[model samples]
Target: MSESSESTIESGGIGLSEDALRTLKLVADDEPIPDDDPGLRDLRALHAVVPNTHRPGHWILLDPQQTAHNLLWRGIEEVTGILDRLTHVPKITEALTVEHERGRWRDGVGSEYIEHADQINARLDQIMASATEELLTAQPRKRSKSLLTMALPRDSALLERGCKMRTLYPYSARVGVHEPKWMREMAKRGAAVRTLSIPFPRMIIVDRRHAFIEDLVFDSSPPHSGWYVTDRPVVEWMSMIFDLYWTRADPWSEPLDQAGRLTNPIQRSILRELVAGLDQKQIANRLQISEKTLSNHLTDLRTKLRFKTTYQVVHWWATAAENSSALELRDGEPFPNFPGTEGP
Candidate 1:
């Protein structure tokens, strides 16, 4: 690798430099492709390390995995989640190491208590760079675009390394302008980005061996200012918490992207809330859309369902819930079918 390639993170054959390539291995593109590079090229085939179009010196892989990684670092990360989506990985975590292990700390718990943001950031970068197998993360708050952008390189390295990773976010994250778009982009690169309706602490677990937990109770707390735990039990437990949420999370495969038309989750949310017997105002408040917006959504949904009144929509929803547990609602369908519900 040249100094230019070294300037950014190394994909390490795992494209640990490119999120999509993290699942792959790579070699730098040169004046001409080399045979040894060809041997390495098998892994790099799926990814391209884009040279800086405007700046000749700088180069990067257009990491697809960084989409989820983007927000995980937002609001101080919810890492692969808050993975810093600490959207934890279930396959790797399910098998916890049998023995209790410790780290280089004085307590030998291998844990570090970091109160400063800069120290936390530096340590996280160091640990993530060292991760060999997987990255699990969570991001509790809606992330800003700038934070997501800054995180691309770090998160992309994990993907490029082919390290397994997943990210967790609030279901509400879908409503954000950036979150939904980010989730869609990242999910394509083998980053498992899921959103939960419930609450979770901001965390990032790397390889299920090391974990970062922010000061969850205090919003005023500094970024990356939290405890770093290496105790196997604690890390395992955090990973487990992530799994519980993962089980309930809505995987981010959208309908229009797949085969549907009613593309908004908020509309589906409204229908669900309506079935729960909440009025429009309540449904709007619960889903965090404005009543006017909610009213418009209701109107649009009604038009799609071809129902004349709110009662008919509710009736169809209730009937669908009762009849076919096998039926699933889709965005493309005129009326949505929930995971276990029937469609009208």
Candidate 2:
């Protein structure tokens, strides 16, 4: 072979035979292969075969039976045995080596380890012993008696430690007679309680530092699975959510007002609209009164309350009406004669 032909054969492997090499050179030189060329067919056939060379420096390949015996059963058993034996061996050997090298100081090092461990234990004990604060938790359904009973004491203890408590219950709990009574008792002890159609995730945050949340799937069992104790951003987030709900909640102190006697139907209607957070236009629409009449009533309210702006009028009305019973007129009773009765 010529020097160039030998070089081509070495570089291109099986496809570098004289005729095939010539065809490939023509293709490389931008000449398309002609349909009638036998060299082109040979080159194409060689190119179609896949090269299965192993990666560099790794030529290990076992037969199927050998692979199964080595990798599946024997290899795993061997690896596990080695790991088990070596689990403590490395540390033990390292310690022995260190002791041999520094005999007298080894005792000091061991004492240092004990001292650090004691410090860690003391810190953890302090955290555990610190009186926990009030906590509010929500569960989707009634938990086991034992679980709830345990929680109740913790809750009471927290409350006794000057922590304010609140709890949310699913609406289903409201249907249970016992549940409401239990909630009422909790309320009497200064804990706020509310019921929602569906109470969200079961969560408890203690003193805004520690939180326990459900991490497992909801299951009804003793080891009522799905409990996770965390002390991080989760606690902060849950505390904020609890405070938001607490602010909007109607406290048990505000008993339902049953007194309904209307001195002025129009004024009471306007007051209701104001408390409902409606704009003047909306109030007029609902009351079937014109915008001008609504404005006139608002002006009268402002003047009567000695207020300067419309906002002041609203604030005065809301403050005055918040605790008052809703206005009502007895059957066949005449509308209470007020100064503004002349208007439509």
Candidate 3:
């Protein structure tokens, strides 16, 4: 509706301005502005000063606090309506939806990239605080003591609330000094931690409702850059990746088989060589190791895998890796599955 064509009512000698009347129409009657009107500045000013507005015909009545609250709620609803359109939950494709949806966000996808450390941390704090059920994270980089200090309290608080927490890291994360300390502290707080040799994305998902995908740019001083995502499909997709890693990942605990898990740098290199079909002498020469030592490490690798042959060791490692899960993204629901591979 455009402005009510009703004649303006004068209160005593005073009359409502065109801007005030237009503004009243918007709040009370959902009127549309057909074009740029000079009166809009006054309308905006009226909205700024008044919390509640009403109109009987053409004149507007305003209550200071109520008018502001009314306008504030309208702004929030405006945002919600916008989100209702953009937030998408992709239709389930060939894959199964993640079982946990306690904190799923219905809002369509929208994103912001954070560049400052303070902004990123604040966003993280907000997400973690909002999480009512679970927190999933994949952090592929090294942790410094300072970062761990900042994270400790917030993470432990979530655990206290009985929220399931799971984190993913590369196998190398297990070797780092600070990583071990942080992992142990979190484990004590009832969080599950796992390591996969395969490369993992750097991201964090809170209650399946939000995801923060880390930026690949590491050049900034404080190193802050990532997307804060609330799109259902995107968050769910991230959840599946975390779950896939969870299934194939080695537990930070000792309940699982210790076999094939201890891979030192040299041994890891040798295994890579073997998988490349390098002979013992060729592998030894490349690593500048004596053939005898190379053979020892290779033998240890096979023994740890409980297989007599180097090929068997490679096959075993490959099989364990397949459980890491793969995703095929399409317009439809993407199911998490193990894509076919020739070998590890």
Index of the highest-TM-score prediction: 3
**Each model's total of backbone clashes:** 56, 0, 12
> What's the TM-score of each model vs. the native?
0.47, 0.34, 0.48
Across 1-344, the per-residue lDDT of candidate 3 in tens digits comes to: 22422122222112346665556567455444333443443544435432333522233345758766866776688789888866554534212242122113212236655657778889899879867999998876677889889999999999998899999776656656688888999999999998754445788899998888875533332456566888787788778777765665666764433345455544655666777788888876555456887778778877766887877877775656422323111124344563463356
lDDT of 2 by residue, 159-195 (tens): 6777777786544455454566667667776777765
Indicate the worst ten consecutive residues by lDDT in candidate 1. Answer: 97-106
Per-model lDDT: 0.61, 0.52, 0.65
TM-score of 3: 0.48
Q: Sort all candidates by TM-score, best to worst.
A: 3, 1, 2
**Winner by lDDT:** 3
For candidate 1, write residues 176-207 as lDDT tens digits: 77787777667766788876544557889999
Q: What is the lDDT for 329 in model 1?
A: 37
Could you tell me which 10 consecutive residues in candidate 3 have the lowest summed lDDT? 5-14
Supply candidate 3's per-residue lDDT for 44: 47
